[model samples]
Target chain A: MADTPPLLKTITIIGPGLIGSSILRRARQTGTLAQKLIAADCQEAVLHRVTALNIADETTTDLIAAAAQSDLVILCIPTGAIRAVAATILPHMKPGSILSDVASVRSSLGPEIHALLPEGVSYIPAHPMAGTEYSGPDAGFATLFEDRWTLLIPPPGTAPEAIALMEAFWHRCGARTRQMTDQYHDQVCAIVSHLPHLLAFTICNTADRLSADLQTDVLEYAASGFRDFTRIAASDPIMWRDIFLTNKDVLLATFKRFEEDAHRMVKAIQEDDSEAIMQNLQRGRHIRRGLMPEPQN
Target chain B: MADTPPLLKTITIIGPGLIGSSILRRARQTGTLAQKLIAADCQEAVLHRVTALNIADETTTDLIAAAAQSDLVILCIPTGAIRAVAATILPHMKPGSILSDVASVRSSLGPEIHALLPEGVSYIPAHPMAGTEYSGPDAGFATLFEDRWTLLIPPPGTAPEAIALMEAFWHRCGARTRQMTDQYHDQVCAIVSHLPHLLAFTICNTADRLSADLQTDVLEYAASGFRDFTRIAASDPIMWRDIFLTNKDVLLATFKRFEEDAHRMVKAIQEDDSEAIMQNLQRGRHIRRGLMPEPQN
Candidate 1:
């Protein structure tokens, strides 16, 4: 491991938020960035904190200046802002530099951002399947991505060298990596991540709208099951809003499937169809048990 | 306190399942039952395990023999079986004894079981908000209920002495106690526990029905949000089925509310209404933050 060269001489991360800060911490912990690290954000306060915390060698509000000297630039901002931020940085990006982002949806975003890159620059999209409900620079830690999967959505004709470099970066960051088409990435995440967040958000709001008396009780007894949903529902709203908008088509399709499933189970409960209810529940338990390596006895 | 007497002189717990065994473990650890601890179940295997574990002073398949001399009797069985089990034990229950259950629903069950009890015996309904996804006697532990809430739904004319005794019993088992009307309890739990479990079960089944290729990706990337739902969905199916059946009215009403909320959010996402989407998501986060006494920064 010590004989292995650093993945990049200098890496510039735009947006020192939760995921970005975690990347910085892990890189510094492992000395993965050989020469320098630059942190860029729109807010002076955030940049000030990043510098004070010593998470970066350089800090700036100028995206282009921060990215100009780096061999790799990762956009760790919201999906909606990625286009504008990447457009700002592309003109100054050096030839042969790698451009990437950590956004949930990538089908359309990958191609759009790829077209923005200089002919010699590469755009590789990655979605790390890791996070807590908390956000901001202080909420992150070095091990956030440990034992997590980070899917790299490399477009067709992506250079083998570029893919290999990005995969190596993720590996060094303690994440298992897989390369997939952006369309398939969105589809898989639509069912697993996007739909569940949608359910948790809607369920939490529904409970909020209950009568004041009942709402109090709902919070009081939340640990019964609702607490799990609320933990997810407390996630950054703007990030999720962008995910819903960017991944609208795949998510709507998944929502339709979920509605149908909910409808069938609702009817079973309404009609006192105990066997149907039990079977549906049993299927859920069976699948969940399969998820674990050792099924609970 | 050591100066305080044990909550009950003798107790019989019917159905040594998860909650039942947790109660047994907690009682044994705290020395809360002074004279006798009887474990009664129709299954000889469960009774055998209970005896082998030394959790009970006496083990029996005969409900009458177990209840005959007990000062308190707890029906820690599924909701549907409570009526029959109560009927079996009522005729043998000592006069002035307290009879309670650890079932999730109380509206229909309370009145039905109250009707089954003999004139001198009192039936109090209790629900302890503590559990894991696992089940059975082996899954139970002494600290399962520590710092968790246990609701006591005492019907009208329930003796002050009876209420005090049950409250003290729950306290000794390491749970805070609250008393509420049966109707209110059903409403609160329907929104918090019942609806969340129903949603988890239905969502897990929906993911389970995905195409094999997509299902594999879902399991691989589940930590994004689906893992939390699966944890709830994996709970004992028979226990949850009985809960939905017994609490059907309130749950159906809550489901209608959830459907409307979900439909609104789905439309928002489909129409690409970023403002509406953000607002809905923000409301969820706001209410979730409000639930925490010390909100996460």
Candidate 2:
């Protein structure tokens, strides 16, 4: 049997942070993601670390030069910087090359980036549906995307060949891929990721604002319940801030629905209506258990 | 050197659920908490499981008989049933025996149970800051409380010797012990445990209430953030319902504070106030990282 060809001839990963570094590591370890892996970051220190780690075929601080030579360029930066970074490199990208990103929010990103693309350069945005509380190059591992879903959002009118190639690329990096419209993607992610993060972040501040003595006790005696929230709470501030603003409409609507449900719970408790409370709790428990077979932490 | 004697001659655990069975298992394994472990439950099936597991020297459905001969009787039942159970067992409790409970709420529990104490009997309420999203006898282990905090909320005039004995008992069960007023315990738990569970349960329901297709996708692609909340929401509904009502005032107040913080986050995102959003996320991340040395999930 003949060996399968590499997914792409050359791939450049910009802003080689956690997700980006993990991709480079996977490509190096598997020897299948790209024939040559190029890592580009604005930070000299990050390039130094990538070179020292030796997970990439080459490292550079010049993103435009890297984009010109690569068959694909993935912007693994924060959501706020996606458009500017895309605009900066899209012009230099090879005529037949693809441009993609790993931003979490995708509501208006598709149209915005679509407008910036040069004639022959195709764009496809993806979200890997995986992460940790930690970030940066040192925190990544080759298996970060293993068994995780990577939803690919290719703007309408994008070439089918480009979409298929991107799916193959993610699969080689150890992810399952699916296609969805950007609008639907935003709504799904709002409930699954954004609202949960909003609650976790808000709860931490609420605990911090307690009286001094009570605050000390809250941290000291932080039980399993609060501890889980804090784990989710400890994520990159700038990245999350950008996500909140980028997906503002969907996130706010999700929060309103959650607030109304929470108010109903409060009323049930206040009225000592055991049946209503029990029904709500049971539905939540059943739905959760049905979806996730194993409990995480 | 002479071996130290068991903490008590007989320790009767009323209700062999998760917490109750865990105590029994610890006592059986360590052989230090009690010389004779008596397990009592309203359900005969639970008693059968306790007998089959051999976690108790004796298992019974007779609460009064178990209390009459035991030097310590701990109620490991729901918060709503604590007062009623105490009322039933106090009259039959041996003279100078200690009666402690493992209820999470403590605001009015101290006074309400104190009024039912017998002449020579002591009442000490304890809240173990540990659990999984599981219930019943089968979901327990001997090390469930290892390195965990168990706050002891003794009534105003609890005997020092009695308090010390209960503290020693919990220590033998692999838990650290602290003494706090009922009011303070409730406040601390409202922020740390009760309020977290409330948010988790509410978020699960919110996700469920989405459009059918969206709900399906939310569960199918349930990311790490939502998965953690679901793990918490999977807890026993009856147990959590009782907790919400029992800690009504503090839980409600904490929820209000959290809601205000969440609204502030929404406003920041709406106004596109990047600085404000960044600051909130950073503060939450900082506080969370400062308190927990390691992430659980």
Per-residue lDDT for A1-297 in model 1, tens only?
Answer: 566677789999899889999999988788865468899899998888888778888998888887889889999999989999889889899988889999989858887877787878888887889998888888778999999999999877788898888999998999999988988999988988899999999999898898787788788888757898998999999999999999999899988998999999999998999999988999898778768854444
Point to the candidate with the largest DockQ.
1
Q: After the best TM-score superposition of candidate 1, give how far the Cα of residue B191 lies from its true spot, in angstroms.
A: 0.8
- Candidate 1's C-alpha runs over 4 A off are A1-4, B1-4, B293-296
Which whole-number lDDT from 0 to 100 does residue B149 have in model 2? 97
Candidate 2 overall Cα lDDT vs. reference? 0.90
Candidate 1, clashing residue pairs? none
- Residue A156, candidate 2: how far off, in angstroms? 1.4
Indicate the worst ten consecutive residues by lDDT in candidate 2 chain B: B288-297
Candidate 1 whole-model C-alpha lDDT, 0 to 1: 0.87
